[model samples]
Target: MPEIKRQHGKQLFLITNTKQNCAFYRKNKFQQFSHKIHLLNRQPLENWSFVRTLS
Candidate 1:
């Protein structure tokens, strides 16, 4: 049951993250996309792993 609950929570997180990403893209368009990617590449390994899961 705990494992199932954890999985559900992860699903919820992904859904919310996706929605936020959509809104961000709409607001920023493609102009900031490259900049964001550059920033992401420069992020530390730990932070990069978390960001990779979103994509």
Candidate 2:
């Protein structure tokens, strides 16, 4: 029936939307994690250089 088809289409759309949202969130989380790692790496290098300068 046409009504059944409409319902099926709506469900499919919802499923795809959720999938896209999940992928977007995963990418954001990865970027945040990499940024944190970059900051951590830079901090140690900066400190080492500062210590070397002092010595």
Candidate 3:
């Protein structure tokens, strides 16, 4: 992740469905960027987008 930040100097974006993992990222300073429902194989799933800015 640091490598990406060093290369881009932009906010990091992540998408995931695991609640536990998302909570972990939130605790570590990532902010909730978005929340949406995504369809996968004809079923709807809750997804979260997180962002971390590098200074």
Candidate 4:
């Protein structure tokens, strides 16, 4: 796990979805390093890998 940041209860928000965003990190892997992965407002889930969001 990443370095301990803020801890409240059993709930933990450590490094949300690092595996999803590649290149965002210097390293090629996600472990111990803490980071925030942005969620796509829109995504290409069908034939494309691009991210797209719908309102």
* Model 1 lDDT at residue 28: 36
Clashing pairs in 1: none
Best by lDDT: 3
By descending lDDT, how would the candidates be arranged? 3, 4, 1, 2
The residue-level lDDT of candidate 4 at 45 comes to 32
Q: What is the per-residue lDDT of model 1 for residues 20-45, given as tens digits with 9 covering 90 to 100?
A: 46555445322222211224567632
Model 2 Cα lDDT, one tens digit per residue, 1-55 = 3564555532211112233454554443321111111256455211110000110
Is 1 or 2 the stronger prediction by lDDT? 1
How far in Å is the alpha carbon of 47 misplaced in model 4? 13
Best by TM-score: 3
lDDT of 1 at 11: 21
Per-residue CA lDDT of model 4 for 1-55, tens digit only, reads 2222233232222332434453443243323433333446664232112221111
Which of 3 and 4 is the better model by TM-score? 3
Query: What are the lDDT figures for the candidates, one per model?
Result: 0.31, 0.28, 0.86, 0.32
Candidate 2 lDDT (Cα, whole model)? 0.28
